[model samples]
Target chain A: MINIEDYAERQMRRRGMEITYARMLPVVVRRIADNNGQVLVNSMEFDAYNQYWYLVNAYELPVGTRITSDTHVTLLETHTNDTMEEFSGKIKIELPASFTGNVCQALFYQVLVK
Target chain B: MTGSTRVIHHPIQLIVRQPLTPVNIYTVLPGHIRRVVGVKVVHSVGVHLMSADTYLPAIGYLSLEFNNRSYHMGHVDVSFDNRAEASDAYLDTEIDIIPGSLLSGHYENKVFTGTDYQRADGTITDKWSNYIVTIYLKALSDD
Candidate 1:
């Protein structure tokens, strides 16, 4: 529901960097079993000179027979600082047994700092 | 030139909210939101000082306060990498948001670097910038 300009303006004032435009990236898990099915969900890396962060939100859900269940998003530094002159890492989503189908999804923002 | 340096401070208290149309409202779920199941969240942050001390960047800290619990993610430092090279720095490890009760989050992006030193002559003192962070909450109601 957040707009583009307002989002950008806030980052500009708060982060000191100006965001021309921003969009959302969906993080969804499909066909997950009811058991602890640890799946390698998503991973990303970037090479930019600026600083940035991704804002992720649950869109679909962690719902099932109960109100909500347990899920995990694992963060790993795939590469070390000496590997590349870059700051980056990898992420893997752990779909809970309660989460089935593609009903569980999240929205995230990919910010590019200049 | 003497120095192109000024302390950077971004004490940003952001509340990730869902936008109605053009205005992004605060992250407070409506009655209709709880009617459905629940949603989950996952994310991270990283920075690279490809040009070394010239354009250094760091993440002072990132935190998430939800379910009456406060989780401090981690920090980012990539200032020692060579210019035009990539220095890998894992800022945030992981953030898992479960559904049910409405949730709230707070991310602190405190950076320290010389903004104009590169343009001025790439020779400035090292200092910490104001904290610039982005925080988002339950945005399922938007879609």
Candidate 2:
């Protein structure tokens, strides 16, 4: 696993930015399933400025099944002459209180900055 | 120990060579100590000008390539509603990794950007920047 905190610091140093602060937020995972039982991966909208990561984990996954793997990514910059900012947070997959079942538990992982 | 057993610690090391410009290129070399390879990138850039004649806006393309081949994955794309608010112009993108084949090799990256300036007579001057960040992902050959 890549340490998000360490990578940010190193990258900033390489680009001549001073390390001012670093914080790690818990991970949030969410999943949705239709009445037919097909699993749907939840797409998340992470707001770095708000310092929050939110997801709706609705499906309870079996222990041994390949429910999901690593979180994939894509990044787009709307402007040209701007610099990329750095921040860190932990990622955890969890289920909501309104749902319950052994087969429907959300897979949670601890996210760390370094 | 085999290559897959090696562990990669946090705060990975990054070596950036020479000055980067719109034409010059650089390489990000990966060590053979990591088993899983992934990338998450985000940026917000906008245009600015001191006067109507001195306008500056930037545009670019980013991709992940391994051994000269680019792995395609599910991605997310976003764009802002307005163009004048340069600071609020936001876009987010994320791409997944490929299966089984180990991420091991020197990856090549090519990037460029263009800007244009025109006066009342419609005379225009176009300039471009070759800016890119290349990454390498590999497992420990011998652990």
Candidate 3:
């Protein structure tokens, strides 16, 4: 029950940023592993909570990883600009009664970093 | 052999099945880093690409929900080891993967990007692929 663009917009706002892109992204759902080691669907309507989602994998990594379109990610906001601080926002996501999981991940895109 | 015999042409049908979907667990304690738990997924379908041209296959992405935000996970990994060689087919190869894990809620979304990967170049090229297949988790003590 979530449109991708709206999801992106709200996600951007929640992250204290605005959408400054030439196009809108289609809402696509992807699964990710949470800290609890559980996979969850990235729902647009549910993308405001910092408690259950993340933008990237690898709990920790050293520098020098290939940043491809495939590896790019958007956690709370739909799109991220050049500034890294724009990713900051305050929104705690609440899963639906039907969404029974300790954690989960959603999928989105961004430019890969070198 | 001459064309005196009748030749029959039979069509090959293709059957596709649904990919396995993974389950996840999201949680956080009062004084612990947030983490995902109970993740389950399966291996993605393989794709073969050929030609020198750069190509990108539009495949479904993975995301994890933490702190009320939807984060992007990378595309599933395609096992190239099984294939002996690359073909001349130049196209994007999309794959569907499902993996499972058990988390105990002591993580950071930003930390996920902090993985120890080789930054030889800006792109994750074939020379040093850091694609992960298995994940190990530490059980959090009950507070």
Best by lDDT: 1
Give lDDT per model, in order. 0.31, 0.29, 0.28
Worst 10-residue stretch by lDDT in candidate 2 chain A? A68-77
**Model 2 ranges with Cα > 4 A deviation:** A1-7, A49-114, B1-143
B1-143: candidate 2 lDDT, tens digit per residue: 45356433212222212111111112332443323343322222222111232222322223223221223232222121224554431132222223333232121111121124422222333332222222223332323
Off by over 4 Å in 3: A1-5, A22-114, B1-19, B24-31, B34-143
Model 2, A26-54: lDDT tens digits are 34345566678565554333333312222
lDDT of 3 by residue, A1-114 (tens): 244455555656664555555232232333354779564542334232222122332222112111112212222211222222112223222222233443444233331111
TM-score of 1: 0.29
Better of 2 and 3 by TM-score: 2
In candidate 1, residue A87 scores what lDDT? 19
Q: Count clashing pairs, candidate 2.
A: 24
lDDT of 3 by residue, B44-84 (tens): 22222212223322222333332333343323322222233
User: Cα deviation in Å at residue A69, candidate 3?
Assistant: 9.4
* Number of colliding residue pairs in each model: 19, 24, 78
- Ten contiguous residues with the weakest lDDT in model 1 chain B: B16-25
Tell me the tens digit of each residue's lDDT in model 1 across A34-60: 357554332223232233334344333
